[model samples]
Target chain A: MNSRVVISNIVRWVLLFFVQVFLLRNIGFYNLSAPFIYVLFVLALPFGIPNLLLYILAFGTGIVMDAFYDTLGVHATACAVLAFVRISFISVTVNRDGFDEPEPSLSGMGFKWFVLYSLLCIFFHHLVVFFLEAFRLNEIGYTLVRCLLSCIFTLFLVLLAQFIFYKRKSR
Target chain B: MRNLWIFLNRYNAFFFLIIFFVAGIILTVRNNAYQRSVTLNSTNGLVGAAYEHLNVVKRYLNLGMVNDSLAKENALLKTEILALRSIDSAKDVTVKDTLRNVQYTYLPAKVIKNSFTLRNNIITINKGRLDGIEPDMAVISPQQGVIGLVRDVSDHLATIRSLLHKDTRISVAIKKNNALGSLIWGDRNFDIRKAFVTDIPNHVKMSVGDTIVTSGAGEFPIGVPVGRVRKTNVSTGDNFLAAEITLFNDFSNLQYVYVIKNKYAAEQKALELNSKNDE
Candidate 1:
């Protein structure tokens, strides 16, 4: 919204991109689970942003990821799904918590709300990612297991990142 | 018209979602067909440069293992050279050698990024069109033997569709019996160390620990080591026998590879195309 907020968001975007491609790309758990911490940039966007702008930002983030991962449109499709889910979830739940909060970050939206939000978003993202990447129905079980494991891994890393950087909301 | 415009404006977000989603799907399908342009892949200059710089740090950490493997390969080559020289000295050449024309030449390359955990793993190497590497060129490891085939190339980097990929298929044969089959990965399991050898005739005698080597019908040269049969008589719906094999290449720690250039590939391809055109 403001200069400071815009600058910080840009910085977070770059930092998360590097972390995803350079750091988390190499750290897979037994070839099954991979943490996509870059999704945090989409999830933690400020509340007042327009829905159309949000989708574009999410698409941009995902397309870049697709480039590095060599999965062309897989991540982009998932990110679009994530963006749609985030918009719907926020509209449904944010009114209860008051619109004063700037972002749906852990520190801003409280622990319980943020956890549910991230879990839902990351699950859908990984679901689309693994299913599309595999692109076969015969391996549904293996794909589902991989999706769930990666969802948990990505959620954990996102939480750790939030805790380390975002300050607690003042009452 | 006013109502239609209002409705369209109201659901514009949904339309945007559909547009982006379809775009992504098209890209995915085009890529799966293996016809994707090189612009968005890791072989692009920017992404390749980043991975190349990162590999500098990674290569340093694995310097000891790389040096040891190189030394071992050098020793093996020395012994073979000595044996060949001794045989040559024992007899003078009386006839012109017709098969001595070079067919395959290898160019050394450093692997910038490699993935084996995913179902469709792709390896990025630091050589590209500038180094004479092209799509379908065979890549082999000094220590582990057959690695993969080059999928795409940029100016300074290339991506390899490794044997772990679901779509990868290489022609291989049982070394002892010359029974031919196709080598594939991720048939039943996502394990990097394991692969499947299918299409072997059911009548062909096979046993555990039987050696498998490239058949030279595809990208690789003849007799390059592929794997060893780990399990026999794996159940398949068809009459063909499928055996589980343990790959010799430790893809998890692959650092360097050789991109093999087939000098006569263009000529052979042209001749083959001529017959297809005739049909």
Candidate 2:
């Protein structure tokens, strides 16, 4: 609720949006590669934020991306789905007491736990995204390749962002 | 009402999530209609502007390659002009000669984005409705080979359904024998098959290197090369020989293309429609 927290959230969203649109848009490694750093916006939200608010914010983030990429509603669909699943993911991975905090940091959750958590979330987001983008089951193999490659790239970017932003003292 | 408000507030995220998912489903179902909606497309004015800027940056990066293509095409055009002038000097040319020398116009445009790896590939070109380009216009490379046809046209951009697309079918024929056939993609590799040509006399001596050209029966002009025969085999069920043709123009490396605007297209279409009605 503090002004500093609000400012930091705004700054993070802006930075992620720029990285996604301007830098990552054309950075396809092969024809099927996808850079999905936009998920960082969802992952960085405070743990105790209302589920409803998180979903709204996630949906909004997706709409902004969809607008830039001209991908119709694919991004929004995937982001919203990921946001809805985040509560279950956090509850399963972290303790209820730990989930009551104002911020979700990799440091707070410890290194190995945060890596697994971020990787799982990234995998879910990428899987849903590639499937929706493909809109078919005929080329399941190709879709899997896309999902894996995108998930790996997204996880790398997410972890890098977490390492740079969240200080050791936050743990 | 107080309880309802509290419950709604508690589930507000879920409510929005459901609404957004429903919207996505509706958009997917009505994709065709949504694609044609000017308002929804134009609403992303900032995004569109950003893409336009990115296009400019990309154009600079691709300048050298584009200039090379332009120079090569210019040389071809020069030779064509000289040939035309020589033919004109011989004023005793017959009506048949004039028809044979019919020249097609070419429009130069950049391929902003192309989707060849997908099943139903659509290419976005920089030229569009404002540039006298319209839907159904046949696009070809500078070498006078078939590329695809324009499917949709906005003010500044047009999407071409590439020949590599599974759903794309072009009226093509054997250039040597004038045998009519349809050029269709196998939907796997760049390989295409010319189907429904069962009646070509076996004596015509079909070979792997035989050239295939547009039949001029449809929107495409005559003499525009489609591809060269890659493989030939007779159908098991029918007497028709299916020939796999390798496309000369690579859809992946497409940079500049020409949009053929037939002056007599409207008249030809109307006459064909009338004949169909009579039948």
TM-score for chain A in each prediction? 0.95, 0.92
Model 2: what TM-score?
A: 0.44
Q: What is the Å distance of residue B226 in model 1 from its true position?
A: 38
TM-score of the candidate numbered 1? Answer: 0.46
RMSD of each: 23.0, 20.6
RMSD of 2: 20.6
Q: What clash count does candidate 2 reach?
A: 1
Q: What is the lDDT of candidate 2?
A: 0.75
Leading candidate by DockQ: 1
For residues B85-199, could you state the per-residue lDDT of candidate 1 as single tens digits? 4343334466455233445666777889989888788999988999899899988886766888999999999999998888888999999999999998856578888899999
Which stretches of model 2 miss by more than 4 angstroms? Answer: A97-100, A168-171, B1-17, B28-279
User: What lDDT does each candidate get?
Assistant: 0.85, 0.75
- Least accurate 10 contiguous residues by lDDT in model 1 chain A: A162-171
